[model samples]
Target: SQELEQSPQSLIVQEGKNLTINCTSSKTLYGLYWYKQKYGEGLIFLMMLQKGGEEKSHEKITAKLDEKKQQSSLHITASQPSHAGIYLCGADMSPNDMRFGAGTRLTVKP
Candidate 1:
């Protein structure tokens, strides 16, 4: 079975600082999905990457998939308190099998 690993299980940053979270897969990834979860709430869809070397951005957040398709990173620029939450990375191993990372908890201090 393949697994997803996320680094820096937790993070704390000052407002306006930049931070990045990484996710690595035990096997090649077919597709990757990024999500944000607020405390006591369900996960919120962020973005998805399917191609190697692909990158996407929305507002201050950016996501990139490595050319090897085994890793992905989520970057947040100019952090804000509103950005505090848990970030999760999910890998689509197959149509019937999806794997998720442990998740990175982010705390943005004002």
Candidate 2:
């Protein structure tokens, strides 16, 4: 699916493993937003970028925006069990639009 579908709806890895999740869209993304949320908890703001081909990262996670803006990727390095959570990438259909994928549920084993 090109409508912002993420792979491995869920992932399980060891405490210090590395992982990557992808987001694909049918059309170019004018705006991209990534959010991290713990189960039953609120989503903590991660990053948002408007310029195509732009990328931003925080802590152990990195997010990139494609020049075509049709795809994006999020990679986590040296994952810690505490890093387990849901990662969601969204595209703006309108200034107020925020469509999200089902999400990539990450589980880091201790």
Candidate 3:
């Protein structure tokens, strides 16, 4: 597809539930960046992985870049409503050149 594809464009989960979102691409991702955007807010950096097989975590969310550089995943453990937002995975070809997935909107139910 030569484009980034995100799974579960929208999701609803219980406050304490665990969930995972996936991102895949047709091109080799030189780098992968994860960002979160709350409703009506700008994107907030979550993490970035320039090396394959790299995994990073912020609070309750953990993201991993597969060795293939063709896929990545974000895992949320013991989610809270505060965690609800749009999760975006962008593929970076260079420092300022990045392409984003449509995003996965996560809704954590109270």
Best by lDDT: 1
lDDT of 3 by residue, 1-110 (tens): 43899998999999999999999987778999899998678999999888889999988999999998889999999999899999999998556778999999999999
**What lDDT does each candidate get?**
0.94, 0.84, 0.91
- After superposition on all CA atoms, what RMSD does each candidate show versus the true structure? 1.4, 1.6, 1.5
Give per-residue CA lDDT, model 2, range 39-65, as digits (tens). Answer: 678898788878888888898888888
Global CA lDDT of candidate 1, please?
0.94
Candidate 1: tens digits of C-alpha lDDT, residues 1-110: 32999988999999999999999986888899999999788999999999999999999999999999999999999999999999999999777789999999999889
Order the numbered candidates by lDDT, best leading. 1, 3, 2
**Winner by TM-score:** 1
RMSD after Cα superposition, model 3: 1.5
Backbone collision count in every prediction? 0, 0, 0
* TM-scores, each model vs. reference: 0.96, 0.90, 0.93
Cα lDDT of candidate 3 equals 0.91
